[model samples]
Target: MRVWILSDLHVDASPWEPPPGERVDLAIVAGDVADGLTRRAIPWLAQHVRPRARHVVYVPGNHDFWGTRLPDELARGRDAAIAADITLLNAGQSRIVEGVRIVGATLWTDYSIGRPKWSQAWGMREAGDRLTGMRDHRRIQTRDRLGSPAPFRPFAALALHVEHRDRIERILSEPHGGPTVVVTHHAPHPRSLPAGEATGPGDAAYASDLSAIMEGEHGPDFWIHGHVHASRDYRVVRTRIIANPRGHDTSHQRRDGSWADERENPSFTPSLVLEI
Candidate 1:
């Protein structure tokens, strides 16, 4: 099948549309079409994207959960997707399409991809603090049983990550008769980062080295992901890992109302397509 792959559209900042008359057998949106408040991402997909593909799969990125409690935002997205006849994957869900087993999850990082030697406890404390300072923690909220909304903190994010990772591992272990594709919002391996980029502890917030999973006997044939603005295509063991993110625009305005250099991702291809 001809599959179109892309992510990190960030439509709230910059809009996108497929080339005129472009179509594919399947379209996989890795995630982060927009923040929760605008609620434009999925709807935009429905109105402008779905008709171009025979099937479309959407995975919610961290930004999709911002501006509301997690469950509420997810519910809204799910409902919209269903109405549009789209498949929305979250919380480690899987679906079979034309003999292709597609597994998807947000796969939040465990904050150790860049610092593998650090103890889990130390990583959680220090790395967790760093991640908590990000906009995800500031904008996305989680609710208590009593319906009180609070920041979706690092601990909670890590717990959800563990759950999703475990599910992926379990699903991949089972036998399947068809090619498997794994989709995640966060980079599944550290190599997903741009080559030549400096590494630091903060890198843990963006990616996790899940090479163990990809190298397993029953691991997926292809893994597509987003979150890191840099686009990449490489192989780990037998799995082909690919990312095509539009990211933010190349330049931004300075105090003088002139554009300054801001190279977010120059390699993004709007027409990226892979045959599987």
Candidate 2:
């Protein structure tokens, strides 16, 4: 019943070894496992991937899209000599593990396309290009003029909304009565300003759906995400919102060759241990 949540850890730094004998039932990697090309597999990755825990679940973040084939490729370990111990969750289908119905999607809110395009898997630039074109020109202008940066995006709003709801529906549609765990690479609900440790500008749709799911009788026990690059704990209705940003490399550089962690320092690493 204990789950460790981690997300947004850019692979520039290796994951630290968990303390010996410290038991974790499940590890939920929200996403952003690496920035682009995760060259050296963290010694811990292959080690802890299929830990003693009953299940280890992974979701893709926007950054992990860098050095890859289809977004789902990371889940499947398409590359030779590369193997991930955890179960990679991508769009489509409900996955059942350890008596839990787990459903996930790597889909982020696509602002430009005005819909959740599956193409975001083609790295950031290519996916961004596709999304940019999906935008509704008129709505873009209207939102721009009003200075209202929509969280779910206006043009793709209808499609994104449907996509979000469908994901929940898919999870609920599962025949098993076991409790479910929803994992995503983006924030699932709204938080106050100073939105500490959350995903970027398109998680509103997921957030909205999360609330609805939690309100229902068949709601998940917990919802975990990792896109924000920091660690935050909150709640969506009765669902506990756990976000862990795994990206640690800081883009901000100093003349003295020093950097800061993700939130402020250059060496912040996101690693959470969950027990399911």
Candidate 3:
């Protein structure tokens, strides 16, 4: 099966637009399927993207649940989608499809622990307070609105990180006779991050386990990830890794200003597609 993989679409519901190619049998979205997974928008995704593919699988990233609870249908419809042959994975599980075993997990990074003490000491408390709107009601905004001094918690954050990695391990233990594909919002490989702050899911902790899984005699043939928005390729263990960012924003274009103009717009690209 020829499968196409992409992630971090971060779609907003207005007019459902199809990708610039023929529809295929499956679309695997790692995360950020829509701006929000609320009661309203989640259904819109089901209507717009799900029906177009024979099998649609997804995992919720930090963005999907950013400051919100899981939508009511996110679970039920997820199961329904699986029943409809559409698989929706959250901070869990593995799904087998057409000889390819797809495993995935949402975004759970160390940053969400709480703001770093150092950042708080280094003028971050006041900034976080102001940004969080404690001083002004209207000032509170989504975490995505800012890009510095991210929340941090060394211990609990570490625990959450271990949990997700353990999930990946547990799934890999099962038997699926074919090429395996692992989908994760936070890239498990070291080369995936930008210089920002060594944040995001601490891949360091899971490096050994990840290496063992991917390097196993029957490991995955390919691995796809989303979080770090860099379009690059690498090899981890015996698996080929592909990291595709959602897109580059031209509004802030001078820092590097090198992305292709045609590919600069914000749009949804189905995470994974398979052709029979």
Candidate 4:
């Protein structure tokens, strides 16, 4: 099967379209289609990208849930996806397409990928406070026991990460008849970080060291992910991991008096097709 992969479109910030004449048997939008869950991104994909592929699988990135409430937002996203005939994966859902077993989830990290010393000394709440600058903490909202609105802090995010990780592990361990593919919004291994980038506590917010799962006996044959803006294609143990993100648009002039041209992600090949 020929698969077309892309992510981090952030269409709300800038417009995007698939390369002309690019079509595939399956298309994977790893995540971060837009900032609003039920807004521009999903609708744009349905209208513009869905018809180009025979099958489409979408994973919701952190930005997709921005300006929305948790759990409820996920439900609404799922509903919208179903209405558009697109497959949306969340909470460790698996689907078998054309003899390929594909399992997907957001795979939120537990803030331990970089193993920062401060994180070990401080609690998750303190760590979360330190990361208040991240939009995930400030923009995404959830309800407390009394139904009061609260920021989706690191503690809750960690709990969710554990849940998704455990579920993914269980699914990956199960026997499958054909090639297995794992799709996630967050990168699964630290190696997915951009080349030459140093690891730090903040890095944990984007990726987790899930190499154990990839090295396991029943590890997947391929893993597709998007979160890190840099494009990557490499092998860990027996699995080949891939990420293709357009990142934020930088077409505007920068303070440095230089023009940034991220409008067309030079590293991204919209027509690049992977055969599995």
| Per-prediction backbone clash count | 0, 32, 7, 0
| Tens digit per residue, CA lDDT, model 4, 5-118 | 889888888777776865788888899999887887789889877998999999889899998998888888889999998999977899988999889898888777655553
lDDT of 2 by residue, 1-276 (tens): 666666665554544444445456676676666543234332334465456455666666555544433323343442421355456665534567767777776555433221243223322233224345322222222123344543223334335335755776676766676777787776655551125322443333233334566677666777777655555667766677766554554455678888743443233333445555
Ranking by lDDT: 1, 4, 3, 2
C-alpha lDDT score of every prediction, in listed order:
0.83, 0.52, 0.54, 0.83
Native-referenced Cα lDDT, model 4: 0.83
Clashing pairs in 1: none
lDDT, candidate 1, 1-276, per-residue tens: 989898998878766666765689999999998886227778888877799899999998998877778977888778888989889988789999889999999988887765555544554565546445567877788876688876687777888899999999889888999999999999988788765231766666788889899887877999999999988998989999999998987577999998887657889888898999
TM-scores for the candidates: 0.90, 0.62, 0.65, 0.91
Q: Report the lDDT of model 4 for residue 188.
A: 89
lDDT of 3 by residue, 1-276 (tens): 656566665555223345556565666666655545554335655776666666667766545554443334355546665555556676657877777788877634433222342231222232224344122112212222243323332333244556877787777777777877778776665555553233423322211124566777656777777766656477876788775556434333455665444443244243434332
Superpose all Cα atoms of candidate 1 onto the true structure and report the RMSD in Å to 1 decimal.
2.9
The candidates, ranked best first by TM-score, are 4, 1, 3, 2
Residue 29 alpha-carbon offset, candidate 3, angstroms: 0.7
Give candidate 4's error at residue 191 in angstroms: 0.9
Alpha carbon deviation, residue 153, candidate 2 (Å):
13
Candidate 4 deviant stretches above 4 angstroms? 116-127, 130-132, 145-148, 195-198, 252-265
* Candidate 2 similarity to native, TM-score: 0.62
